[model samples]
Target: MRALVLDRPGSFRVAEVPDPVPEADQIVVQVECCGICGTDLHILAGEFPPTPYPITPGHEFAGIVAARGADVRPDLPVGARVAVDPSLYCGYCRRCRAGRDNLCENWAAIGDTVNGAFAEFVAVPAVNAYRLPDQFDGQLGAMVEPLACAVHGIRRLGLLGPVSAEPTVVIGAGTMGLLMLQLLLHAGAGPVAVVDRVRYRLEVARKLGAAQAVTDASALGDVRFAVAVDATGVPEAVETAIGLLDRGGRMLVFGVTPAEAAIRVSPFRVYNDEITITGSMAILRSFGEAVDLLSGGAVDPRPLLSEPLPLEGYGDAVDRIRAGQGIKWHIRPI
Candidate 1:
């Protein structure tokens, strides 16, 4: 099997490696499509502390079951197509006991903490795999992971809270931001305003049902929103989105900001306006819901899909993502 081996930080190579053999409760998946995300870039740059060297980095992926361990469930036989939840939580952690596994004390994830699906074959826990419809190709299946994160983020935003038709603002038009935008609409959260520096992304956001799309939040000019989401992961953007919230407004910080990043906010205003600020980490129990949404066409994947490259072109894919050239780029390992 050939895999992208990150020899160390800032160095990697596509090299032949031994095929993964599943444990008694695991399954081996023949890689099909794996999406490149910002986290992968962080791992490559040595910015993500949890990642160990000489590993493969690709968490958002889907593929066909190539082999199963002796104890694997009969329902997940070979040839079954599936999307994997990369989260690796310590079941005994305090947070896990409290039903907040995303914040488990020993937080880890496939691709980030172990060899992941950026290869021809990867082994994963059978319980982490969610079956995909036979008609769904690996490309569409790969979207389930990211969509699951969006679902969890929305849940954190109080999706079932008192319905207010007031508009919501989503800062950033990247894959995650767009996913959040669509979910907000699907949940009837009212007209959504999308903000991105790129004009083309804003156009795509509009095509995907954004009531307002602009290069900057200031363009909306004095019109505050009842809800504001920061998906850019930039301190300035997060600060600006927080400022755009109307009195009594709520904010969800869904993006992964740098550890050293800091934002400025008016403490007095937060107290007087009774503002609410919250954050959602990675996927929780939302994977199944995301699969349902995608399968039912509630969230369209076509607009976000971009041309995929072969596994050998991983470096080019990274460059494309860094350049913000497309919505989502994937690696076709098979």
Candidate 2:
């Protein structure tokens, strides 16, 4: 099989690799589509180390079952469409037993820790694959993971109030920000505002549902929001969102910053205003909920997709992402 291997930091190469074989309780999937996530870029740049050298990079993917291990249930026969739940955890762990698998102490991401779906075929534990509706295309199904994450974050904000018309602000206009914007408007937010440093992304945000989009933070002068969210994946953006919240307002930290990054805020103001600053990690148990949203057409994320390339184009794909060229990129393994 031809796979994109991260040979080392600052490099990726298309090379021949042996096809994966499923364990007794696992299944082999013929990967159809894979989404390039921000974590993949960080891994390639030597920022965060999840695995040793020479690993395939992909996690957000969907495909058909090509083969199954001997112990796998025969009821789930070959050719079943499925989406991969890339987070593998020990069910006996304290966090997993407490229903917080996303926060498990010994968590291993599929693409980072293990060889993931960046090739024609990849093996995964049967317990980690969720069977999807037959009509669900792999391209659209690949979005379930990220959409599920957005669902977890948006629901955490408790956006619904008796009024259903509170002013909400979303900082950042990337794929995550746009999805959050759509979810906010769907939940009946009032005059949602989107902020970003890039002009094109802000425009996409407006088309998705933002009432206002601005590249300048000064444009938000004196604006108070009932709910605020930071999706820039930057500590500075989180701080900005904290300052934009109204008294008793709720702020959701939906972004992930570097491990070394830190933001300092006033403890005095936090105590005085009754402000709620919450942090959201990966989707807790929202994968199915996200698939339901996309399946039902309540939120349309199709427009957020801008680029599609084959596995061999992984390097160019990352370049485009680094250059701030588009919202999201998809890789077709077929």
Candidate 3:
């Protein structure tokens, strides 16, 4: 089998590798499509500590079951179409016992702590694979992971409805930001505004449901927002979101900043204005919800994709994403 292996920081090679066989309670999946995420770039740049080297680096993947290991359930048959859950949590952990598996003390993400799906085949624990409906293709299935993250954010913020038509702001206009903007609109948010320095991304944001898209905050005028989402990992975006929130407004930080990145704000502002600052991490119970939402045709990610590239072009795909050249890029592993 051929794969794009990240042997070390800033180095990736496309080479032939041995195919994996599943262990007990595991399955071997023939990967069809995998979406390149920002975290993949983080790993490449050495932002996060490298997991085991020479690992196939991709988590947002969907494929068909090539084989099932011993003790596998007959219901989840071989040849079943599936999308990966990616998160691995020990059921015996304190967090898992409390029903917060996303906060498991021994949590390990599939593509990070273990080998991932950027290959012709991957071995995944049966618990981490969810059967997808026949109507869902690998291309659309690849989006389930990222969309689940957005769904988790929305739930964590406890975004109250009767979400006013008054201006709502979203900063970043990147992939997550664009998705959140669309979701908010679908949920009845009005006059939604998106801010970003990139003109092209702002244009894409507008098409995705942003009522107003601007390269500079000056264009937002004196209008205050009832809700704000900071989808850029940049600290500047967080600070700007804090300043833009109306009294009693809530702001959700949906982006993952660098470990060293810090944002300093006035405690008096948060206290006096009753502002709420919430941070969302990985998806919890929303993976299934995201899949259902996509399958139900409630949210369309097709317009969000700028291009799809084959596995051989993985490096170029990464470059395009790093350069802000596309909304999202899917890799065809087959």
lDDT of each: 0.92, 0.84, 0.84
Instruction: Give the higher-lDDT candidate: 1 or 3.
Output: 1
- For candidate 1, give the lDDT of residue 131: 97
Per residue, candidate 3 scores C-alpha lDDT tens digits across 193-215 of 99998888887887777889998
Candidate 3: give the clashing pairs. Answer: none
**Candidate 3 similarity to native, TM-score:** 0.95
Judged by TM-score relative to the true structure, which candidate is superior, 1 or 3? 1
Error of 3 at 163 (Å): 4.5
Once fitted onto the true fold, the runs of candidate 2 whose alpha carbons sit more than 4 angstroms away are 159-163
Candidate 2 has its poorest 10 consecutive residues by lDDT at: 155-164
Model 2 Cα shift for residue 68 (angstroms): 1.2
Write the residue-wise lDDT of candidate 1 on 1-334 in tens digits.
9999999999989999998999999999998999998899999999999899989999999999999999998999999999999999999988999999999999999999999989999999999999998768888999999999999999998883346578899999999999998888888886899999999999999999999999978789888889999999999999999899999999999999999999999999999998999999999999999999999998988788897899889999898888888889999998
Taking the candidates one at a time, how many backbone clashes does each contain?
0, 0, 0
Candidate 3 Cα errors over 4 Å, as ranges: 160-166
Q: Write the per-residue lDDT of candidate 2 for residues 30-90, one digit (tens) a residue.
A: 9988999888888788776667678898989999999999999876679999888888887
TM-score versus the correct structure, for each prediction? 0.98, 0.95, 0.95
